[model samples]
Target: MSAADDRLAARVRALAAAVEAAEGRSDAAVSADARAVVERAGERVAFSGSYTVVALAGATGSGKSSLFNAVTGTELARVAVRRPTTAKPMAVSWGSELPHALLDWLDVTGRHLVPSGPHELSDLVLLDLPDHDSTEVSHRLTVDRLVELVDALIWVVDPQKYADAALHEGYLKRLAPYADVMMVVLNQADRLTPEELDRCLGDLRRLLDAEGLRATPIMAVSALRGTGIKELREALARTVANKQAMTRRLSADVTVAATALAADLGTANVPRVDERLQRQVVAGLGAAAGVPIAVDGVRRAWRKRGTVATGWPFVTWLARLRPDPLKRLRLDLTPGDHSPTEVNRTSLPKASAVQRARADQGLRELTDAATSGLPRGWASAVRNAAGDRRAVLLDRLDVAIAGTDLEVRRGTWWWGLFGVLQWLLIAAVVVGAVWLLANPLLLGLGLPQLPPVLWYGVPAGTWLLVGGVLAGLLLGVLGRALVEIGANAHARDARRSLEDAVRAVVTEEVFEPVEAELARYRLARQQVAEAART
Candidate 1:
């Protein structure tokens, strides 16, 4: 084998290792697509070096029967009189040493041992596959799996149907990527005139080129007449002699499988969250929970500057008194408090079924777009990851909104009553204090300013009235400030909780899967590069 061929074999081994890694982590939140590809690849690698498979693939009645007989030098495969008779695969080998391990892996137990012949093709273990246009679905699957794993394929096309659409569309188009390991044989040249044969060959060449098979070797031969059997034999012999052809074929298979496995890795470039969307979600949740109104009311009532005694002491006491509205209503709005004690659906906006459905649709669309460049299996993995966590995501969001709603406390009429009683008590105390002092000189100074009744009967009545009025005004301001403070705190708490919830869902359900897939892909790619080097 050439140095290049040695490198190619090594590369295949490396690719196998990467696939094994994926399989090992199959249960660890891996994408379904990635897992499938890795599993397929691992199976192939496990069976490598077990057997040498040379598959005969071609259009219907392409004289592959004749060619198969000539190569094996036996009537092991039925010929012309029995054209298209084999409806299934038949294998012939020249020796018993042809590796039972390989045969077991191919799942073909009906093995035949053909005696070694003088023909150069004797060393090969030949496979006469069923017609590509077979009526059976099993036949098609057999052909497909063989095409994926076979060391080399001999594509036989007779003059009559060299350009058959079924062969090109159903087979060649899909196998274009494997062109390097494929060979096109223009069989049954005996049926055409020299000029007609030349034109047919030319047409076949053009078709092959159009199918992205420019580098694949094309050969013309008459399998029945055995006109070009010697040349075909020599070509097969040369490939076996060097061992490079087989190595290159294996290398190409490894790369193809690797490409599929690597796609399990999520996208390298992640789409970021839009700032506008973030802001909108935050505002929407806050407004729907009535956070702003609560905060504003508290701020307006609670003032930092105020006097308890000089300005209607009774009223001032009422303003300074805090309602503790959220606490009284049994709202659990403390930091680190995740769920609400009670779900106030009336105050909070519930995500409707329609909204949940929309979210699901959006997730599917985003996942599809993110994995558009990946293999079908890898794309499937992303989809499963998104689907599995969808309900959980919605539920967490609902809980967050509900939790916020409970914190948006509205100071009701009872709070106003409490304010009034607090002020009245302060007024009573201020009146009693002046009455107890009973200072005649201080009372006389205010006597002239007081009403005649107040000057004669009650000494501290004027001062008491002024103190009660000032106290009421101060109490009203304090009530407003307390309400505002509570509202602001609740709003901030809800926002933080929501942010945490969102991040948790995204990481567990989305980012983790993406990371696992990427790891598989990176490993597969590494294997391909290493195998190529070997």
Candidate 2:
């Protein structure tokens, strides 16, 4: 617990932050007991740094209380009476001052202080814990709490119960993370012959090793006959002298919690967003938004303008009477109105339920592909983010359509030119009809008639009238063909611009939120890894 503990402090903080980060997201992020472990570590470290709280835990017949008394060289644990566990834990402090705050935080109501003296175990605060195998629920609970909170454990077992399954499976195996500060004591070794003691110790060592505690220290001591009491005291003295047992125990608890969190965190490889997927989404939403209908309107609107400008001079006014197709859908943004008004919601037909369903399904497929290998919790989170703005999706779509400038403005210059030429041909036909009528009048009045100009031996008046009418009809046909081509190109431009607007809306409503959630997951994963590193 010196300069290097600074690193331990930082690691513990990271683990605490991770637990806090995952608090509301998922319950499986960490075990329920991990919070208590974190709280204990924080309070213990802030208190007396010199004191090492070592607990002696065992079953009812293990004689662990007597072993505790032997190590302390005092009758503090009441070896004759086993009913002492009916009370709280008994802590005998070996230092001059009482660690009232520390013991109170430990919930140890029973406290004792030995006179300050030059002893090797002065920095130790030894606890005689309740038997773990007690039938009473309170005693078992007491043992369970102290087992997790104590800085070190000296598990006292006898030759008869050294291979007990409850002790090995329920406690030892589960506590493999704390092996650095845990030890096994074979109490009452004097009752067994030397050969029997060797056999029992070897067997117990094998059991501990199989439980993933290969480095856990083992000592055989007969508490009643004082056989190995001196060696146990020397072991505790060395454990206390370093003043790092508490730090190690807290670090172990951090490991246990971090392991649980890391297990709950699934794979960290979030797939990159594919533009094709985005384009597919845009295409799907475009259908739902009636983009095809809008483009058709654009084509018709362009042709309508052309017809009013280039149709037969006699019929052009009738073409202008009909309403433009795009204006009917409220998608008609006039030229030079660069910033379309989103408030002018489109009159386009609302999407049917089937169309809405397809849009939703497409979005789901896209998200699933993006987070394919992620765990259920994170995937659910991302899905939640994607759907967060769903209630207003249609409303926002209306805004996007209304704000699109469809570029269906003035027709090509050929329409105006054709209209002027058709007007000139009509004038020629009128003049030729007047001249033909006047020729008869001149003859009846005995006046000279004008000479008739001829083309291909036909009367000039007849040719003027017939040729002008035919030429006007041919020019109208040619103008219609040109307008058809220009309308298609205009429709394409309109479709491209509308699709761009729809993509923006989809990105705002879906992609941005999902990516933010993915970013959040990455940060949490990095913190978890930092906490998990030993």
Candidate 3:
């Protein structure tokens, strides 16, 4: 292979790799097309030896058989009188030995003897290929295969059928690039006058030129009258003798392969998800849940109230001044007569049925934008898959929030009251003790003269009793306040956690997978573009 050929191959391989990396799937059609091109290249490589294969191709009744006979100076190719008569190919070899490799490659088994006549052009192998305009598709395919493998082509045309639509549209337009190795013969020219032949040959040349075959050689010939046969033979012999025949064949094969490979570059439309849509989804969800509001409520409640360690009843009531986090989002958490459970967000903004529908529509719009212009079938498939995922996401969100304990626990409010009553009982005992000691009536019963014991002990005992009761009451107040604060904090934390969880479930598990599926759809668009090129 040449350096340029190597570079082209490397470029194709790199394209395959880049496509695979970006889209996570290999280009199957591209690889298949490349393989086919490489196969054609290999065939051309094998033809670089001593062989000159000439292909005779044209539409039915174009007189290719007549020209084939005139070029070889023999009636070898059956000059059928009927239209579309050549059912199989006929090979006429010039040299004593047949080019077995070329013949086998062409799959031409039918061979004939060229009688010892004009042996001047002894190196050329003339193959009378089947008509491309034959009714049988196999015959047309055979002609097409020969067109790719042959070293040179002779397009024999009758004046009447030279401009036939099938010959021009199907074959001439496609094979125009090989005109360097092609020659157009207006065969059976004796049937037409000089003016008619001139006009037809001129038009044929113009058509070939229009098909990208500038300076393509055109000759007028009559196989019956032996007109221009020697010139055609000389042209064929010169083409083989110069060793440019194989080069032309290789170039033709390259063109054929390139054309086939180009077909695979068609559009494969697949839709995807846009990042803007994703951001919108996240923002909408955050707004609907009122997460920021709930967070703010928790922060205010935390600052206004003290810790639960302080046992105070008044402090607990102070904690209630702030709003409940769940309540702020309108997620009702009033515990039922049964066990404690999560509050349902039936009345929450955007959580209502109509609001949910709108949110779903927003998500769908984002998904649609990501995968815009993708095929309806592929889009539907991805949408179905996303629908399944959204169900799972909603279920998971419900489960996370539902599992939180939102009900008031046991000993919540009564514990602080019990601490207050205990302090009061201690105060009563201290007062009774003081009164018993100071009373003159109680001392008359031979009680020892409590000298100054009442003065110091009674006051000290009274101060001790009041101080102990106040300390217990303050502790009770602070402790109860702390408990309410802690509970409030827990509720706020649980709400935030649930918000995040639900968002992630809807976006990652639900939205992101949908996005990936949409990406898959977008990547498929290459197939459509490829088809257009083909």
Number of the top-ranking candidate, with TM-score as the measure: 2
Task: Report the lDDT tens digits of candidate 1 across residue range 1-534.
Answer: 467655655655576566565553333333343334345445544655434468888756888878988876778777666465456777776644555666666766556876554545445667888787777878777877777656788899988888899999988877776787778999988888999988998899899999998978888888778888888878777766555555566555555555555544334553333445444433443343334443333333222111222233434556457554333322334544435554432223345565445555555555665566555555566567656665565455445444444333344454556455556856665674555455564587675332333444664555565555555666656655654555466456655654555445455666566556655555655664464342
User: Residue by residue across 253-274, what tens digits does model 3's lDDT show?
Assistant: 4444444433332344434456
RMSD of each: 9.1, 4.1, 8.8
Query: Model 1 Cα displacement at 429 (Å)?
Result: 9.5
Residue range with the least summed lDDT across 10 consecutive positions in model 1: 301-310
lDDT of 3 at 21: 27
TM-scores for all predictions: 0.59, 0.84, 0.58
Window of ten residues with lowest summed lDDT in model 2:
79-88
Looking at model 3, which ten-residue stretch has the lowest summed lDDT? 525-534
lDDT per model vs. reference? 0.60, 0.81, 0.62
How do the candidates rank by lDDT, highest first? 2, 3, 1
lDDT of 2 by residue, 360-408 (tens): 7788788887677776777788888778888887678778988887766
Clashing pairs for model 2 are none
Better of 2 and 3 by lDDT: 2
